[model samples]
Target chain A: MSETPASSVPRRVRDASEAEILDRLLPRYAAARGAEVGPGDDAAVMIQLGDRYVVTTDMMIHGPDFRWAWHTPFELGWKAAVTNLADVYAMGARPTGLVIALAATADTELTALEELADGLTAACARLAPGCAVVGGDLSVSDTFTIAITAFGDLEDRAPVLRSGARVGDVIALAGDAGRAAHGLDLLFAEGVDAAGVPNADATAALRAREPELVAAQLTPNPPIPAGIDAALAGATSMMDVSDGLALDASRIARASSVALDLDTAAFAAEPNLERALRGGEDHALLATFPATSTLPEPFRAIGVVRAGAGVLRDGAPLTGKLGWDPYTAWDGQLG
Target chain B: MSETPASSVPRRVRDASEAEILDRLLPRYAAARGAEVGPGDDAAVMIQLGDRYVVTTDMMIHGPDFRWAWHTPFELGWKAAVTNLADVYAMGARPTGLVIALAATADTELTALEELADGLTAACARLAPGCAVVGGDLSVSDTFTIAITAFGDLEDRAPVLRSGARVGDVIALAGDAGRAAHGLDLLFAEGVDAAGVPNADATAALRAREPELVAAQLTPNPPIPAGIDAALAGATSMMDVSDGLALDASRIARASSVALDLDTAAFAAEPNLERALRGGEDHALLATFPATSTLPEPFRAIGVVRAGAGVLRDGAPLTGKLGWDPYTAWDGQLG
Candidate 1:
């Protein structure tokens, strides 16, 4: 891989080396405010808010987390950024800038890295408008991996925490759910094809045609501002949807010491109720509101919090566990 | 390893399974942030700053970046947090939160993980006062690795960038340099002890005394607030010390379209000029200021930026032949 000269090849998506791709991607955010520094330095510097700031990070691995055959480099980059940004947004903070660390094989195609950068730039353009891809480390690893750390500002509004959920609060969702899971189901379930057709194509087409689901899988649109809106609207408890709603709601229930009774009927009209119940990677905003509070647009009531523990559907406990936990007996495959 | 009941053991550092150790560690953060969401949840919520946020991430691998015998889990954790937080702080922003991704062997001891968590907590307490350990993922891998993503708040200040350096700026250094390289030299060279004796017993005190060197190696103290101070002090160009000073300064010079000339006399006056020149992991701040700007306390003038390209010491170009760059044709073994 070292034998190939970086300049000899045309600048294709998968032909650029990590450094080459970074050079192309860093300049896109030249106009962003507070981006006193951009990518390529040891680290990027931004202005601080009051005395406090919000920070978070996440990593994406090759085999366990994603596969190159199913997703493009751009999609992978977008997903990586979205995953980290969602955490900040979940905190009810708006995301501003980013620093990315990449580990790739020495022989990996440079075009692939360029595609990844393109995906990253697309996500940053939307989620973190003026955010810069500041500093990062590059190394030749056995496998390809991308790690992202995101910085956010908490605009002085109180952070919406999970423990704030209370009995009698209405549970709501600000984005779609189960789409990514269904997309994965179509991708791995066999008999599904990329081209739109009938028969099993219904599931495959649903996975591909549904921009929400495909987008959910490839590049999650984290509702960072929506979270802030929810916080300002006095949201009691808030979070992002990376796991199934039941599993995530159970987390809130465990933290708030309250039972979460999800209304399956509320989502009965939507396809794939089981996926919605057991799906992951939606990157949606799930919050609990007091009975008297009014919800903003794009948010729909999905359930209610009760004075108990665990998650239930129509007052009955939804069994057949639906969530990903590292301790559980995982088959090393996505559900 | 799976046979051990992780729940029955004391939370203190104990040799147990990874599952058991994580079971203990995850609950603490959840309990500590009783008001915030627990770690078990998909994503955590933090407060938002303005309309946007800053983000960064890094990964530490076992073979390439770190070795098990050389560092305990606590030290590893501390290093991970420091590296990630340094990026945010280098952005002239304050860190707000963190999410850690850990990959290790199933046979890993629970106590090791506890120590790692303790290290992370210690660093967080010092560097990021109010930030939360928001969320993360853990998985079994062939080798041990830790990846950390850190988030920060750029309250409202302008971000400090690398492109702002200009000609005729005085180069300054805040914090020590080259200590880690010296420590590495001692550790790998003749098995000489790098860390000074703990002042516990005479038998353990036979090795060389290099407190500054060992501390630089084991735990790098990133100049967090100082980066911001440089920005406020009208620093024209700035960066953190990761690679050797020569290579990093060259980067600043190239970016700013200027040449940087080092005062060899001043460098030679330092206790360990070799370490200061070629050492890595100092985590110190290197900034360029107007020749007329007031020098901040504790900052040392080391070089000056002039009209041209590359870095020079005593009017001679430094090709980093003596500096650190992994790809350089240096033997793996240190001198």
Candidate 2:
């Protein structure tokens, strides 16, 4: 959850027509490569590359996923787009285009919605350079909701699946670890109540001191090119660590019928090592490569793939809380 | 603007964990072609044909788009899938796969969600022979929301865009235009109160008398094959009449820089001409072809594309409210 306050603009969605909202937000999505027909059509037409395409969808709801008090509409949009892009990259594909489904209360400020659109396009331009927000649907609901679909082109490389990890492979990671998880701590440390209400005074003070950590949680800039790079380097199995290390690593382990043994000593030099191991939304790629292969830039070996099951920390069985599980993690109706 | 009450089922979403829900719903999706990684992975991998792909997304919210009392979970899921498939066909593409993003309050019944999943797979099987729900995300929200992405293969045929219609082309339509609109009226006349609440007593009476009309509104089965047929028979321009005939026709008119004049006389033999012209969710193909072209099955001449602006009803300017525009059309935050 976040504490990003609602924008104080006067004209809300209910005040304008749907056509007006579309007119205002549509311009934010500029044309990108391979787009034969762009937004404003019944559907978008884009050129697919090679013989395959990679696709994924993700959602960030207001209460369970974020709080307006902690994120600007722009940041929320950016984070939503970037995190979803991380998934495409996780599959060893180059992020291509997107279609967004945005729902909010009728009283939501138009400026807020525009800021959100700006954030989406801004992330596409910065993180996935060749991608664009090609299509979207807008509607009114009781709370803010965003469902984004991201597509990717694998070039000529075959997709790397989580089930392909072979025993004797070295497990590596690309991008920051545990940053978003710690970022969430900083958010809650601002004196957030169990009900998720943010104390304005604490939030403002934290904003002054822990801006980077807060930004990390609000607008994660995961390494988008690493997945394709890993695939090019012959990655056998890979996935984005949105669900933290041990839990996600176990997923790969079970899928590939291999166990992942991580060395805690590998993180002795890092601060918040626990967060790195337990934080979800790290949005980094966890991949397995051939044992003797040289790892790519910004990627380092963190574990080894072996014939077994589940995940191990320093060769010991991993247990306890490791990440967010929207269902069990939060009790009852969050919003 | 609906009057249906909430479901009375004892089990709500908050009662189960996400894993449990996934366990119950995943089995309904089964499998499909081109999906190499499928669901349960970080992202799904699928093969793309030809050089380009057609993509579109649609959203359905609880109150504005549907009501629990008015339909079943299966129908809701099926409607969402079928309507989106209509969009792919509108672009003259055969749908190959889909990814759905569904959100509902934690208190929502798990059974409802499962029924929805069943509906999605059922629609894919019936309307799109080889299509599958390849990927999806589940989240908690204040209201039920479903956002679906449907991708299609053009089979190397150039996409027939709305901008391709030319002056002197004849406008033709496949599938029923106003079936859904009249269906809505049937729902309302079943003694829906001002709060949009359905009177259960009246609902049962109307259901027994007008099952087909109610089904049209709740589960529109558009002629999906008509889109490909129109494209194969040399359609110049095309679109699905989702937001009523007049409004959508005007959209093509604006895109193609041509005026469309519909001959009401063409509907003299029809029973629901007004509903056909003014109802949204008709989920039918509206296209333009060369005047001398031989049209295929289910398509009939309705109007002509000519030099001018806007849509005409029997040579007269279209007036009155024509279709849905959620924001301005309804008041307050629904659902």
Candidate 3:
């Protein structure tokens, strides 16, 4: 946690040399488990477990991706790592190493960067043990940005692809679904001032009102272990539920050329079924298995694959808004 | 190459959906050689050739890293790939895959993105055959940013680290040195208008006047293949010469806990020895080999390792302005 600064302000990035910044920050990020050569080299070398590996990349920008007033730097770093790690886990692989490129304005405080590094290491320690930042780059930019690439080891198991679903396969879900979306809606409606600017006091009040929802939106804890469990339990197909359950399920349906029929009664216990169907950024694991196979722990049956296309709810066409698309949805508005 | 517009501007990124943009751009980036699942899945699965792998990352932002008037989209993409590939090659490894995260404004033209993709694949084809873009992410930002993470196959060879150099080793150079710095000087002195804005006509005229220098600055072709050769020929220590020769050589000396003595006569044929000694951004290969071993064809001996600390020119301590540090060097100006 950072101390509340006085009027003079704390030391900024521009005040320190690049080498000084690295000397202060690199030690905070834990080294990767199997890295033959870690940071301070031209490249980091990692020991491989099998003959195949999985890699995924994701980016989070200051404007469209997040608001500084609503989330701390630690949360941003944690979410950035979690997003890419979820992608690797979707393939039933254990994450091994990560390479991050962080771009920030010179006026930004060094404490913010230090907290961000702390958050990255904390997430890896809690979610996927043995995975850590192995190498990274830092640069000055007009906009603050965090770009991460995660690598994983398969250990000889075949990758679980979204196109492998078969007719009569049972669809299963792991982790929270609609909570993050509900939290975002709450933040927009009540956590901002009259001018749509995020207010610290207002955000704190909103978090107090809905702790679980706010936490889910700020720091999601996806079922990372369940991905490998589902794979080992004979999953036919798998994906990360990033762009809402319906949209991501539709992707699996289209990729496999099959229809997914969800039972509305199955999710009746969810606080908000609509948000669960149409919200985004939960990063939960969505997987399909043979009808005869038992569902993996933490994974519950939600739908079944049929001989058709598109997504269905209770044997009818599912419609309305699906998910977030950064290209078309962003309206040039900052936090 | 993009055609010069007559009057009306081309379609901007905001006009098309995310899916539409991906459909137009993904095909231009060729598939990675060993990718079992490329681009479409949550993560890409790459077949490993050995029990070890190399990874590195680098970032290029529009304001601090490049100017649109001086660099075309193709050149930006090519240089981005080349920079990271050089780091992998510095470890004596063969690059195999890259995952890029690109963030640009909504008003950016689609042709620019297309050309960037073309340049990425073209660089792979020319510099490191069989390596290609395998996965990536896109986002909207106020500043254009390209963050790339490159992966390489070690294939049973030991990685050449900068800390392995010993006394009596012969230091060698394998690529251009100071030419890019001279090209940068030309751009700043003659390729800009009165207001310090980069002028297209002036840049073209400068390129026409000095083809190789301008090319080295904008589109450098580093000695990627020579890295593997040096390793095969028993390189003791290696590094990618991103900073000036003197500054980067100091890094090797410090890491190895020894001194390096450069012979000024070795580079007597250079057009500008000062730039060669103090300019950066060449992405050349600098390595050390045993005194008894024969130097590789592309590698020419330039100096020798001595039992001391720091770098020296003709047995004297080397001193002057060395290289660049983005955190302190950028002045918040754009072309």
Candidate 4:
């Protein structure tokens, strides 16, 4: 018989199960506060606050949004945690804890799960110190999927909303972009071999090594701490990089009754212009600062907020419309 | 052609779409707290605790646990929320918020999703007033699955745990038992269409009609308020019903160094004695009271805690197991 369609092939490796992933991931979160009972219990027990709590969740589906050929379980796990944690950080909060729900096929191997958990552990260790996984449920399904819910503590800071961006503010980006997009391009491009490569292998060593682009796609270092820093620095508005810059900038522009104009020349000077502009999954922090505020390090000046609507590049309209929107048709492939 | 095997049939409804289901469900949760940016937003937002928070999550998969024909979208949503909420409440906390992650075939209809959301909202309204549907992610998948994470506030009460039960205590249950098991029996025998016809019709006619068994199966009512009450009443140990009474009771016994002597005669008075002993999903509150403490109203005194090693039924050794265990060869069904 002819080979099955690539789309119909199960992308997940069978030997690494979700439980094995958790076993590798849970220990790193031992430092979280009020974690009387952590992972492995029926549920995790944490010290509860009398005040309100911030909560959010997200899911990563294979095939439709991600592919096993491009990403390892480790990278997928890390990216999933970052996506959820960044939302909490964008609200001007410190993540306290998280709960994960995973669904995989019965044949998934334990090692693959371990690698995914390692990615989750690495990400959580960076974003939420002392936070431990409390409880989760696992089941066998036709494809692999992960659902995560992150809880955060506002710590008395006012929440930062997309609508808070004001006119005449300076729009700045903190953290790198385009690396992930480049990485995705390299992974999906024909005649490339990612499986044979070693971890220490430099991006330049590979024929398609695009360091800046690949970094952005593979391990999105969400400026979570920087979001808090911006909030403390009196940022008026803030959000994370999920959709492309052009699309997300438009959202801020629409919310604040202002036109967001990006300096394209500045982006061009960067390593990869296309990746910096349209590249998504950067998890970078974009905030609006008033004219009076002094910009901090790593916070690059990208654009300005003016009295208008929609995003502009170098005073000209951006054509392709780069960014993430659920209703629209995405590339339907993961980096 | 001959009729297709049940396994070959699509799990989701062919006519209703996913988007349609979301449209209907979003409005029902319009009143939930922290729904500032509900379903349509990139990520939902809510107020965070000025301090700490408790979080937990669970996942339900088709085939391994549930069949589509046996449960409606509403029941699945409601039960998913209930299971997660019970974990939070078991820690002697009151639920404050929820996040859902869903995966279904693209062919699934919107009406089905709306029903699921309806079930979720209905359960939340009764269990956690003003709790928000903070955020979630959705995707099309080969199988139908759902994951839910719930958060809660302790409100100054100390969390009651399983480790606190001691000798010379009274074992009590607040809420009915075996109803879920009996409902499962009916469901397996007649399938969802014919199962609980009386209760289903009564629910349509009068909302107050107590479909104890059927309701137990569809949507378990975890005693959130009662958990707080138990903590306030100086309960030594407490937990929610998930595994059968015998197994869960044995857990308490092992943890508390007490032998539990359950009165079989008391359970025999109930219509479904076997179901009560082995059935799960009761979501009922089981707690141990000190000898000097007065039992609360509506709570049935089912057994006594004595210094010993394991669980007993009417002072006799249990010849057969009384609760469900994951390691065992279960028939692959939900309680």
Docking class of 1: acceptable
lDDT of 3 by residue, A122-226 (tens): 999988899999999998888899999999999888999999999999999998888888888898888898888778889989988988888898888888778
Model 1 chain A: ten consecutive residues of lowest lDDT = A190-199
CA lDDT of A306 in candidate 4? Answer: 76
Candidate structures ordered by DockQ, highest first: 3, 2, 4, 1
* Ten-residue stretch with the least lDDT total in model 4 chain B: B198-207
**What is each candidate's fraction of native interface contacts (fnat)?**
0.28, 0.88, 0.96, 0.55
**lDDT (C-alpha) at residue A108 in model 3:** 81
Candidate models: Cα lDDT each: 0.68, 0.84, 0.89, 0.69
What digit string (tens of lDDT, one per residue) describes model 4 on residues B109-170? 66677788888888888887777566677766667778888776666666677877887788
Report how far residue B25 has shifted in candidate 4, in Å. 4.5
Relative to the real complex, the DockQ score for model 3 comes to 0.87
Q: What is the alpha-carbon lDDT for the whole of candidate 3?
A: 0.89
Chain A TM-score for candidate 4 is 0.81
Ranking by lDDT: 3, 2, 4, 1
Q: Which ten residues in a row have the lowest lDDT in candidate 4 chain A?
A: A196-205
User: For residues A99-158, could you state the per-residue lDDT of candidate 1 as single tens digits?
Assistant: 677777545666677678778778878877766466566654555677677766666766
Q: Score the docking of each candidate (DockQ).
A: 0.25, 0.78, 0.87, 0.36
Error of 2 at A214 (Å): 0.7
iRMSD computed for candidate 2: 1.0
Per-residue lDDT of B26-83 in model 3, one digit per residue for the tens? 9998878878889988999999998899999999898788888888999999999999
